[model samples]
Target chain A: MVQAAAVAPVPVPVSTEVYQRLQHFYARQMQSSDDLDVPAWAGSFTEDGVFATNAFPEPITGRAAIAAHCDRAFAAQAAAGIVRRHVMTMLTAEHAAGDGERIHTRSYVMVLETRRGQKPTIYCSTLCEDVLVPVDGGWQVVRREVRRDDL
Target chain B: MVQAAAVAPVPVPVSTEVYQRLQHFYARQMQSSDDLDVPAWAGSFTEDGVFATNAFPEPITGRAAIAAHCDRAFAAQAAAGIVRRHVMTMLTAEHAAGDGERIHTRSYVMVLETRRGQKPTIYCSTLCEDVLVPVDGGWQVVRREVRRDDL
Candidate 1:
């Protein structure tokens, strides 16, 4: 008879201050997306943050470039008369031992879209992997990769 | 002209110990689900924990009931020959100010299903709301509500 070994647990410690800061960062990110505030959305990232998605081959880097990307995307959604709500849930974060100032987090993202006088629908489901760093006394996303789960 | 007020930020603090415990709790939950270990899956919750879903009208309460629920669900999945990967991401936990022992968390849950040779498909997407408490020196989910996004 073969014996099964118990799995050892992995411990990840995140400070109270860091946890709150990261929560605020993600809250702002979702709020900006829902409100279509391109500037606020872009400002959630670091000055040289990178945003990449499976749909786009090239990654968008820098705060300004990210702002432009959001502007174009929001404009297209507006033209289509589609209102979007981004609901982020199931967020797990780990402190990066290699870099004390950084944290790595993964979240489940659902993009809900609604048309005028129509019911909302789940437009997309994605897994978001984020690398965050403390800057200016607050946490900012340094890199965000959106992987489409529906694909 | 009236100027719009700046949005005040919401602050939620979670301790380093609590953060790591919650991460482990979620990890175990996902691991048990993937492994079809009913006892381990149900043990992730409190003895009197409640499991509720939008799809199911009645809530499954207590450890025994929760275990039975998992057993039935996993059996059905096995019958269908579907292997599921429960990817939990975007986990944000806030220490409840009024309750020192309890924490409130929200996470994004994506269930991907694969057959023998077919590519994986997004089986379901949900926003999970959980109330967790420390029991036996480890965090256990006291209440979990699954809100389906793709419904």
Candidate 2:
């Protein structure tokens, strides 16, 4: 009979308050997209926040650029008569000891697109890595990098 | 121009200790599956824990049943010469005020399947809702329900 070695659990280094705030941020993120409020969606990040993905090798920096990017993205979807719903899940946040200023998180993002009288289809699925910081007593994303997982 | 109403963030009610434990439990859960340690994976749940999914209408209840189910599932995957990596993300834990005994969470789960000589493919993606409770000074899953997001 072979025995398996015991493995210790790794603790996610984040305070309860930070975890709750991040969850709230993600919820608002999803809601902004669902409501097609591009400005609000861009406001989720910091003034100089970065949004990067494999498709766009160059990171979209600053709130203005982010808003423009979202505006175009949302407009395209509307033109196609498609509704997009972004779902973020399996999020885990980590912070190093004595480093209370910033927190890192990883999550799975799925974009579901649907048109009238059509079944919803998954348009994109990616793994998102984020860095968040506190501003004005609330959490704001400073950087976000998305990598395709469905390749 | 129509102005969108300002949306206040909804706070997630959970203590720092409980949040940390749940994160640790999930980390261990992923590790157990990655290592193919069925017993350890099953042990993550409570004695009367229930694992239910849309695909499996019948819930697998109790630690023993969960272990058996995992054993068979792992064995089948091994026999097929396929490697399955379960990635959980966007995990959010919440508990109502005055409800300290049980905590609720929502996360996204993605399973990537790879063969010896082939590229990795996404096997499935689902949203998971979990109920956890403290037992023996650690968090243990009491109930897990999975809803498929990609069909």
For residues A1-151, write the lDDT of model 1, one tens digit per residue: 1233234334366766566556656855785776689988888898999999997889999999999988999999989887665777777888775565678899898886766555456788999999888777777889999999866
* Local accuracy of candidate 1 as per-residue lDDT tens digits, B22-97: 7677888898999999988888888999999987989999989999988899999999999999877656678775
List candidate 2 stretches off by more than 4 Å.
A1-136, A140-151, B1-11, B15-17
Pick the TM-score winner.
1
lDDT of 2 at A138: 68
lDDT of 2 by residue, A26-130 (tens): 865775775689888888899999999887869999989999988898898788887665778778998733465778899898886666555556789999998
Tens digits of per-residue lDDT for model 2, B10-111: 436565566556667788898798778988899889999999998786999999999999899889999999898877765667774346567888776767
TM-score of 1: 0.61
Worst 10 residues of 2 chain A by lDDT: A1-10
- Model 2 clash number: 9
lDDT of 1: 0.79
Candidate 1's C-alpha runs over 4 A off are: A1-136, A141-151, B1-11
Could you estimate the TM-score for every candidate?
Answer: 0.61, 0.60
